[model samples]
Target: MAEEKESAEAMISEIHKQITDAFDVFDHEFNKTVDVREVGTIIRSLSCCPSEGELHDLLAEIEEEEPTGYIRFEKFLPTMTKVLMERRYRPIPEDVLLQAFEVLDQEKKGHLEPEELTKYMSEEGEPFTQEEMEEMLSAAVDPDKNVILYKDYVGMMTVEDN
Candidate 1:
């Protein structure tokens, strides 16, 4: 039992060490902070990589965006903690998807009409391009209902494009 505990501790320690190394490398000014570009690069290089759009979603989730888009280490910790805690990576959480959906679902219908979704994507913070929004809509929306269900939206966000 003690041996098992020791092994787990070792694994955690190793992971922490790797994170510290990356943090130091990306903190170019040694100020314990990094810009959006550095965060993007580090995230892209990580094991369970995110798509560019997903990276934007992550940045939003972290809520670390300053006027200059500089993210301090503390502000970025929650995202790192969650990612590290997951045994196997999954895409964005259902609750996060729901929150995002709610922002655009002005009617409180629990789903987004195509136009409403388009408007939201274009008008919301870190606005999506028309092409990107169209691509997401085509991939996630139900043709019959002409709306995006929460499950479908979560599934779309969670899918890791190869």
Candidate 2:
């Protein structure tokens, strides 16, 4: 139980670090501050999918306290930590991922060649950026077979082996 608590703390620390890094990118003047208007973009860049209303509410809270129209890192961290701890933004489910893969696996072969998967990922709805495609393909593709074992990919996506 102690170990679990420590692990959770470590995970939260990492999340905070990621948020800080994302926030820093928008802090162009090296002031550790950003315009309140950029808060939603910063949050989304951290991959926290808050609804429009939820984001508006969060911004409203920030704006109320930060009448200066800017937010500092100290203020940003706690708010983001609470949002993350709530798990309001969750990963996609395994079944949904598998069904999406099934659509791409036209012949039902349970796998797809790297080229095939790349084509679909790049050409389909909400096309992945090059870096996103590379990151995903690196994990999903099997060099030995030269194919994406999509079921395994889905497991990697949905399961936390750690």
Candidate 3:
């Protein structure tokens, strides 16, 4: 039985490897055909996410792509998904409070919803209270919540701010 289990694991790994190889080829080729603006958004999304799953889902939602088929970056997701996927707590950007808030505002709106603001923290199954979410959203308490103008969105994540 142990031998059987080992063999099964080996087969699964091999299959996964093949799938990943193929996905890279497809992603590369398809990227060449996408519009510059679209590509820019996708790249921007990836810059914020720890994994590709978050990138994929958010991009898919933005583009209205059906997420049911072909989640290539199944293991790689954003901060929220990563928390749930790994089942552990990880420290996020601490000192760079302003930049963290800006990126969390995927839509570039004035402020983030409590749920959106807290998703990354709660992604590991740690739900946030209304007060916690409000704290994160209040610019007076945390300057990160200050509304980011469209002009400010482009350079929000640079280390130069530090």
Candidate 4:
């Protein structure tokens, strides 16, 4: 039991370090604080996949606490740590991602053209915003082919199980 507790603590310590490092990059003023407006960027940089609504809610909560429009590291740490530990930002499973791509690959081509991806991502249910679509395409698209090799994209979206 103690061993489990210690391991969990170690994992949390590592997460905290990563979050702090990410936060530091945006805390340019050396005040251990960041502008409220930059919180989304910072969170994304940390690889926490909160939905747009979830992010908005989180920012609303932060604004309620730090009305000065700046967030101190101390204030950010625990909340972020909780979100991380709870796996609220867990990556999508590989199989699920693959299935989504399969649906998009209606012609059974094992790939999708950039324009096709853009249309679906922008027009489908729970559509991605332009910035979100661009970010995804930047990582998932093969510039040479002008296509998304969906298997490769799924690999990028999911972490390998140890």
How well does model 3 score by local distance difference test?
0.44
Per model, state how many residue pairs clash. 0, 0, 4, 0
User: Top model by TM-score, which number?
Assistant: 4
C-alpha lDDT (0 to 100) for residue 4 of candidate 1: 100
lDDT of 1: 0.71
> Which 10-residue window in model 2 sums to the lowest lDDT?
153-162
Please give the ranking of all candidate structures by lDDT, highest first, separated by commas: 4, 2, 1, 3
Per-residue lDDT tens digits of candidate 2, residues 1-162?
999999999999998898889999999899989988899889877667666577888877656453787887787888888877776655567898899999989999999998898898799766778998899999999889988999988988774312
Q: Indicate the worst ten consecutive residues by lDDT in candidate 1.
A: 85-94
Expressed as tens digits, the lDDT of each residue in 2-99 for candidate 1 is: 99999988977776676667777889899978887778666644455566677777777765434467777776665775676573344465677677
Candidate 4 Cα outliers beyond 4 Å, as residue runs: 1-9, 159-162
Order the numbered candidates by TM-score, best leading.
4, 2, 1, 3
Error of 4 at 61 (Å): 2.2
Error of 3 at 46 (Å): 26
Candidate 1, which segments miss by more than 4 Å at Cα?
A: 65-68, 87-162
Candidate 4, residue 139: Cα displacement in angstroms equals 3.5
On a 0 to 1 TM-score scale, where does candidate 3 land against the true structure? Answer: 0.22
lDDT digits (tens) for residues 1-162 of candidate 3: 999999977865654554344334446545323332343243333233234355445445434244433333443223324333343322233345556666777776655554554566556445556675565445322246544342243334333311
TM-score of 2: 0.55
